[model samples]
Target chain A: MKKHIRKTAVLSILTTVALVLSYVEAILPPIWAAVPGIKIGLPNIIIIFILYKTGLKDAITVSVIRLFLVALLFGNAMTLLYSAAGAILSIALMTLCKKINLFSMVGVSIVGGVAHNLGQILVAMAIFETSQIGYYMLVLAVTGTIAGVFVGIAASIILKRFEKIKI
Target chain B: MKNNNSQKNQKLRNDIILAVVIVFIAAAGLLLFVLTKQEGSTVAVKIDGVVTDTYPLSENREVSIKTGENDENINILTIKDGKASISEADCPDKICVETRAVSFVGETIVCLPHKIVIEITNEKTDDQIDVAV
Candidate 1:
C-alpha cells in the first residue's frame, strides 16, 4: 500500500509539473526569431528527471501521456502529430544513451535534443511533402542543443536528491 | 558505485566531443543553406495547405489575408523592393511578424496557430529559354 501511494503521488506530481511547463511555454513569447519551431523544452527536464529516477517504461508512459494531454488541451491535430514524433524520438534516444552510460547527463541530453529536432524535421517534411525545408534543421539543432544543455543541468541537480529518497 | 578520476576525465572528454560534433554539424548546415538559396519573385499565400493567393515580389503592396472560419483573423503581408514579409498579424503568437522579409525561392513565413504559410516560388528568367523558339 505504501508503494502504491508513492507511485501515484510521484506520477501525479510529475504530470502536473509537465503540464505547467507546457502551459508556460505556450504563453511565452517566441524565444528564437529565426526558428519558429524552437522552444526551450522545459517539459523535457521533467521527462528526464523521471527517466533517471524510475526507468524507461515509466518514462515513456509519462511522456506519451503528457503529449496527448497537451495536444488535446492546447494544440491541433497537426501540431499533436508533430509534437508526438519529437517526444517519442527524444525519449527513445535518451533511453538508449542512458543505458550505455558512457556519457554524463549533459551529453545524454545533447543527443536527445538533436534527435528531437531531427524527429520534428522528419514530420515537417512529411507534412509539406518537400525537402526544401532542410535548411531549417540547422537552426532547430542549434536552438535544441542550447535548450538541452540547460535542461540537462536542471535534471542532474534534481536527480541528486532522488538517491536519498529512493523507494 | 564510486567512479575514479579516470572515469570522470573520460566522461568529460565524451561530452566535449559530442558538443563539438553538433557545433560542426550546425556550421555545415548553415553554410549549405546560404549556398543553396535560390531567388524567386513569386509568393503564394496558403491556408490549411491550400493556396489562397499569389503575388509578385516586384510590386509593393499590402495584402490582408482573412481566414474563412474566423472573420476577425487578419494577417497583413507586405512586399517591397523584391522582398515580402508580414507587417502585422492579430494572432496570439505574432511570430510571423518577427520573420524577416524573404526573396529567395522556397523561403517561408509560417504562423502555426493560424495554419498559414507564405512561400516564395522561383520565376522563369528569359536567359533559360531557347533563342530558336
Candidate 2:
C-alpha cells in the first residue's frame, strides 16, 4: 500500500511539473520557423518520463490531469476541448509506439509530437469551419517530426540518468 | 547468442524501413508544393468565424479581414486588391500568420481554436462553399 501511494504521489508531482512547463511555454513568444505551428513541446519530457518509469495508464492519467488543469488556468472553456483532444491523441500515439518497441525513445517522441500537431489541426479545422487549412498539415507534419525527435532525445537522456541512479 | 544477434539485425532493418518511409513522405510533400506553385497578383483573405473589422493594406485599398473575438484576433493581410496573405493572429501558435498568401485554386487560413477558416477557390469553376464545421 505504501509503495502504491508513493507511486501515486510521484505521478502527481510529475503531472504538476508538466502543467507548469506547458504554462511557461504558452506564455513564451512563438518562434516562427520554416514550418508553422511548431513548438518545443516542453511538457512532453514529463510525459515520456512517466511512460518510461511508471506505465502507460499512469502516463495517460498524468497527461489528462495536466492538460485539464492548464486549460482551466490559462485557456477558455472552448480551448479546453481542443487541448484535451490534442493531448489524448498525442498520448495514444506515443503509447502505441512504445508498445511496438520498434523505435527508440526518440522515435516514440517524434510520433507523439506529430500526433499532437495533427490532432490540433483537426480540431482547428472543425472550429474554423473550413478545409482550406488542410494544406498546413503537410508543414505541420514535417515540423512535428523534427520537434518530436528533439524532445524524445532529451527524454531518453533523462531516463537513462534516472535509471543509473540508485534512488 | 544467435537469437540475440538476429533480433538486433531485425531491429536495424526496421529502423531502415522507417527512415525510408519518412524520407519518402517528405519528398512527396515537397513535390506537391513545387507542382502547385502559382504566380498571381491577386490576394484574398477569408475571415474565419466572424469578421470584426477590415483594415486597408498599404494605400492601394487592398483590405485584410480581421476575425475572432476581441481577445483572440486573427488578422489576414490581403494584397492584390484583397486576394491573399493574412498576418497577425492572437492564437498561441501563430501558424496562420506564417502562412504565405493563397493565390492558387485552393488555399486557406485556419484558426482551430476559434473554429474559423478562410479559403480561396478558383472563383470561376468551384461552386460549393461548405465550411467544415
Candidate 3:
C-alpha cells in the first residue's frame, strides 16, 4: 500500500509537470512563423523520463491524460485528433526502442520525436486528401530531429540525478 | 572498467547510426519531391476534397474564398507574376497565410481548420476539356 501510494504521488506530480510544459509550449510564439505546427515538444521530456524510470504503462497513462487535459483547456476537437494520433504513434515507437535497449535515452527520444511528426503529417494528408503537401514532411523531419535531440539530452540528465533518490 | 567503457561506446555508436538513418530517409524523400516538381500553368482551389475553382497562373488577381456553414470563414488568395499565395485568412492558425507562394506542380497551401487547399497544377483547360469530350 505504501509503495503504491508513492508511485501514485510521483505519477500525479509528473502529469502536472507535463501539463505545465505543454501550456508553456502553447504560449510560446511560433519558432518559425513561415512553418506551421513547429513545436519544441517540451512535454516530451517528462514522457521520456517516465518511460525510463517507471515503465511504459505509467508513461502512456500520463501522456493520454495530459493530451486530453491540454486539448480540453487550450484546444478543440481538431487539435485533439491531430495530437492523439501523434502521441499514440510516438509512444509506441519510443517503447519499442527502449525495449530493444540498443540506443541511449537520447536515441529513444529522437525516434519518438520523428515518429510524432510523421504521424501528424499522415493525419494531415488524410484530412486534405492530397499528396501535394508531402514535401512539408521533409521540413518537419529536420525540426523534429533537432527538438528530439534536445529533449533526449534533457531527459538523460534528469534520469541521472533522480537515480540517487528512491522516489 | 574497460568492459563498461566499451558498452557505453557501443550505445553511442547506435545513437549516431539512428540519427544518420533518419537524415538519409528525409533527404531521399526531399529529392523525390523535387524531381517530380514542374512549373504549373494553373492554380486549382479545392474545398472539401472537390475542385471548386481554377485560375490561370499568368493572370494577376485576388480571390476571396469563403467557407463554413454560414460563410463565416474567409481566405484571400492572390496570384501575381505567375506565383500564387494566401495573402489573408481569418482561420485560427493562419498557416495558409504564412506559407510561401507556390508556382510548381504539386505545391499547395492548406488551411486545415477551414478545409481549404490551393494547389498548382500543370493541366491546361483545353487538355482537360479535350479529355472530357
DockQ of each: 0.56, 0.32, 0.71
Top-DockQ candidate index: 3
Q: Per-residue alpha-carbon lDDT of model 3 for A78-106, expressed as tens digits?
A: 88989999999999999999888899988
**Which lDDT tens digits does candidate 3 get at residues B15-131?**
989888888888998998889778999999999888999999999999999999999999999999999999999998887998899999888888888999999997785598999
- Give me the candidate number with maximum TM-score: 3
Predictions ranked by lDDT, top down? 3, 1, 2
User: lDDT by residue for model 2 over B1-133, one digit each (tens)?
Assistant: 9998887677556644654566568669767876986543333344454443432322244344444556445454555444555456566656666766555555665555444455554432223344322
TM-score of chain B of each: 0.85, 0.58, 0.86
Name the runs in model 3 displaced over 4 angstroms.
B125-133
Candidate 3 TM-score over all chains jointly: 0.94
Error of 3 at B12 (Å): 0.9
* TM-score of chain A for the candidates in order shown: 0.95, 0.92, 0.97
Worst 10 residues of 3 chain B by lDDT: B121-130
Give the DockQ-based CAPRI class for model 1: medium
Q: CAPRI verdict on model 3? A: medium
TM-score of each: 0.87, 0.77, 0.94
Count the clashes in each prediction. 0, 12, 0
- CA lDDT, every model vs. true structure: 0.84, 0.68, 0.91
